[model samples]
Target: MTIHLANRVETLTPSTTLAITAKAKELKAQGMDVIGLGAGEPDFNTPSNIIEAAYRSMNEGKTKYTPAGGLPELKQAIVTKLKNDQGLEYAPSEIIVGNGAKHILYTLFQVLLNPKDEVIIPTPYWVSYPEQVKLAEGVPVFVEGKEQQDFKITPEQLEKAITPNTKAFILNSPSNPTGMLYTKDELTALGEICLKHQVLIVSDEIYEKLIYGDNTHTTIAEISQELKEITILINGVSKSHSMTGWRIGYAAGDKKLIAAMTDLASHSTSNPTTTSQFGAIEAYNGPQTAVETMKTAFEERLNIIYPKLISIPGVKCKKPQGAFYLFPNVKEAATLTGYESVDQFVAGLLEEALVAVVPGSGFGSPDNIRLSYATSLENLEEAIKRIHTFVQNKTK
Candidate 1:
């Protein structure tokens, strides 16, 4: 007899970007020239200084596990970075480092949410938020934001979605999938709503440093002193320092919650890699030049690509204030091409144009698609040309 998987397994959905990346790899193996916009990673290398620090840690033999919360020095560096960059103060005791920002978020859900507790997530969210809430036996309540409002949920929308069981709201600025960021006034409004409802805010600021033009990223914790105790500030070195493989991310929040998360980490993954922790120290303490340089490149690419994408008939995209993604409303493309959904549109684009773009349905929206401008300028130019070709022919 076959044994069934656990009930928790039933609640999980596979990562859509990973699935698309695998398909792209399969096509490449079959001799196709696949341009993948599906990857969520930067195309840049980790900074030399950070790498050197990691090497030094290895030579100095820092391979063993330390405190599960994180190395003290690493936490101190994070504290300094938070205070200097964001005007937020967090002590080492209130910080917990995990394998990645994703893991830190999952730990928060596990620690704070009980079965049937409700989480408010804005639509066009990062794909992982809903699934993680479900894994913790919590329910996800989605608030839909259309293309007209820059994909941002209003404070009124937040108030309407609240229920007796609502426990937290997932807030991501310069958001994944949509690349939509809430302005400072907008965030303050949201913070006020959450404060009134006594709902915790899980602020995912992973792409905090990758914004463009005049757009500034702000933290909910910085909005008010009272909200500081209620907000979980999640960030890491991966996106900004090109240190994704380093497996180091940390959260700053209420001391009790931080301690619980660290206890959970101790019994589970233990301390994040020791060498990586040292590397993360340098990432936070060293020169900020690498991050600025990467931001400059991203901004240049955004300026070059956003206008080009809007010029493609049937594709509608606003210039994202930040982040490397361009989420275009391709519903018209689907209607003209006879594809019933965004997934089908993406499949057709991949098969015909040899380009990979993510369908927005994965992020809780349909009839739209996400294009990541994280690759080189030459690649971006060619991919858009191919997309233009595909769209023109579909019209015919």
Candidate 2:
């Protein structure tokens, strides 16, 4: 008899960024000089203060399990940070810490979604939203956003997509892939729609601190008092503090939902790493100068890369309000010789210029590609030059 694999395992696809990274690694093994532009992380070191806190914790023998929800000290720190930075109020009991934002999102999907339950996700969404929804035996309903609209769905589109079975909508501002943030007026519009339909809002605010310019990051909970009751706000110290390796993220919401997530976490991962929790405490409670410094760097890089990307032939991109990615519409890339889908465009560019980028198909859109500018200035300049060269060659 042949061995059988689980259907769920068979159906799930590999994360696009990880898959591209692996391919880039394979090419590098063959002695190719690859410039990787597919990563979704800060290329900065963890701040020294936070690192010292972790060291102190380890020296003090804090290498034990914490509460499933989180260490009280860390939770309290998060409370203070949220109140100070985002103007959101939450007690420690209303929060649950997880390995990362993605982990908590997956756990929430599992806990809340039943078979055939619907999740309304705005496209182009974070790559994990639809996949996680599928893994939980739930359906993802995508509402498309066009380039004319800054790739953000409007209230009309959102309302038309909702149905009686819609359980939640995954809302990300300073959104990944697109970097499109909803303005206060836009959130008010969406908030009212969700309120009338009785739909829950899973507001992913991981990129909250990284927003660019005058773009204020608003939580749906703060839009109005009534909407606050139905919003589950997910945030973390990863992007904010360059602590991606520390793996601390959290969710804030109604006590019952928080309790359910806490229960799910208890049976699953049990607790996050202990020393990392100490580090996270410092990340929240410590001086926020490092966060500002990193944001400054990102904004500088964005200013540099956006114009360069748009200058290339057949490439049209809008300046992102937040996040470290540029999603350039490569539809004109098809008009060039030997390029068909966005995937082929990216693969060809990688093979020719040795720059690894992710195709937008993974984010529920075609005709676009994502380039992560989360690297050094030297690397960014070289990558942009190579992309320009590749596009010129393809067109000519």
Candidate 3:
């Protein structure tokens, strides 16, 4: 019998980041020494305080379901965190917690988009954004962020992309592949355009707490009361608390939007993990010493490895202001190494040098490659050394 699947599933592209990580693991399972730089999560473990919270919750039999959106305590904790950190205020009714930031975003797209409605996504975006929009039956309009501008789109570009069918625009600061952050003035300029056009802004701030030296994270919704009303702010504990597996993320926006998302989640996920919610409650309210520790470590790694990566022949990169990834333009490196494309060069690096980094084509930048520096200083140094040697040998 020939079985047919949904057209949506057929059109979706699997995540290239996960694909590389899996291939590296497959080699390692066969006793090959593979060093993977493809993973997006922190290498650190979840803090003891957060873990203890989950254990306590389970011991107290808090394993049953909570409200579909989230537990009231967790929602209040998120509310408090937003107020204290971002200076943004939200009632619990305006926030909806889901399985993770990714899940929250998927739900947001589903509820906000109608068929053929367009979502403007800047290039070098997170790999999942366009795919999720397509899954929701929405079109994704791409706007390239020039490399010289630190891979950030401009207000002019935003204005050009808007059409009558443009429903929402995604803003991922301290962005996934590039690690570039938007300053306050830049965000205000973009916000004005969105407000003037009456387009919704979806701000993904999952990496807000991971900024490096002299760089700060700003939430666009906090720019003004009016912009706040037109924005949906997305965040979670996965990156900040090194709690990727805990899977707790929340969104705050208009009450009607939140309610719709909650309704859809109730039928789909029912609720986020009960133990994870308790853990996240503590993540938000507990002392933030662990978060600071992880941030410091990532910054230290970046300072150590970024210069070495740039020194490699034919490779150039701007120092990332935030996040733990370095997206280096490797087009010249690909040519020097005798490969026709960045993807081919990356494949050679993985198969020959046993170093795994994500190809940039998945992020809509085919001339670059993203290397995550979330691992130890020692591992980072080793990976760079291996990459340098591979490029030199291939070029010779």
Estimate TM-scores for all models. Answer: 0.98, 0.98, 0.99
Write down the worst ten-residue block by lDDT for model 3. Answer: 373-382
Task: Assess each prediction's global lDDT (C-alpha) against the native.
Answer: 0.90, 0.89, 0.95
Full ranking by lDDT: 3, 1, 2
Model 3 misplaced regions, further than 4 Å: none
Candidate 1 stretches with Cα past 4 Å from truth are: none
Question: Highest TM-score: which candidate?
Answer: 3
- For model 1, what is the alpha-carbon lDDT of residue 98? 93
Candidate 1 per-residue lDDT over residues 251-342, each given as its tens digit:
99999999999999999898898999999999999998999999999899999888888898888887788878988999887777778877
lDDT of 3 by residue, 1-396 (tens): 999999999999988998898889999998988999987999999999999999999999999989999999999999999999989999999999999999999999999999999999999999999999999999999999999988999999999999999999999998999999999999999999999999999999999999988888899999999999999999999999999998999999999999999999999999999999999999999999999999999998999898899999999998999988999999999999999999999999999999999999999999999999988788889999999999999894
Candidate 1, residue 155: Cα displacement in angstroms equals 0.7
Q: Against the true structure, candidate 2 has what lDDT?
A: 0.89
Which wins on lDDT, candidate 1 or candidate 3? Answer: 3
